[model samples]
Target: MKPARFFTPENLQIVKRLVSRYPPGQERASLVPLLDLAQRQHGTWIPPSAMQEIGNTTNLSFEQVFAIVLAYPTSFQWRPCAPQLRICDSWMCCQKAKQRDNGIFEAAQSIASQYGVEVKTTSCLGACYGAPAFWFNDKIHTDATKETIKEIISKEFT
Candidate 1:
């Protein structure tokens, strides 16, 4: 709640570089980078107070951070029990492998839920070549199958 007080020298350097990227009066354009740094430092979603700190650093106000928070999906607070899974359910994946695509979703949910991990579906992970892909945290799984999905969740979550 108190902005975590966990700022590291590396984070400061990153934010400083980001701020320097914009023109003199347009430092606010660094909102994306600042939010990214906040998320990386916080190890999850950006807390509201952290957003305020971002505002302080970027010469913006908390209200501005609030607006950006809603605009960016990455800034939202992670839901309860969610493993933060982002499955690709795009048309290309569905066209190439609908059965496996559907199976991957079901398998991930079922297996992950057993370990209290939440499974989420997304339209695309931008890996069309894989036909079916998913992102678990920062890791990517390509051409995922139901059995593979189960194994992945089992190994990662439990």
Candidate 2:
């Protein structure tokens, strides 16, 4: 996390959007989104330069960057992030993770990827309280229903 990072003009817009989420005096709070942008745009994981960029853009110290980066369990190896969305299929969810009209999650998977979000059926997303849950881009959506999937697709991928 020592070197600075450079971004293409298009990707720079994303950085700006992430940075805009915080108040003027709380720029450092944008670190999470900045790191996510770095991983999503650069692929696999956030490199040293990306951490440096986050720290520089947020006007934080290298030590701050080091601590936060180490705190999160970001992966070094790439997975199915090309549109990764894992729907919970634990016993409770197996019954709920479905289209209202169907008994399986196949339709949900199809609908998600049709809108450009790759998906799978997994056991748990730590949202037992919300039986039907899904994980996308490292964030979890609890109480996921058909309408929820549609809305997320429209709001985020559209």
Residues 29-52 of candidate 1 have per-residue lDDT tens digits of 998878877877877788887887
Model 2 per-residue lDDT tens digits across residues 1-158: 65334666788898898788888988888877677677777777666777777788899977788687677653432445477677887877766654344433665676776877776777677788876778766778877777777777667765
The candidate maximizing lDDT is: 1
> What's the true lDDT of residue 91 in model 2?
76
Best prediction by TM-score: 1
TM-score of candidate 2 against the unseen true structure? 0.55
lDDT of 1: 0.76
Note each model's CA RMSD in angstroms. Answer: 4.4, 6.0
Clashing pairs in 1: none
For model 1, the superposed segments whose C-alpha errors exceed 4 Å read 1-10, 13-30, 40-45, 56-64, 73-75, 79-82, 99-102
Clashes of 1: 0
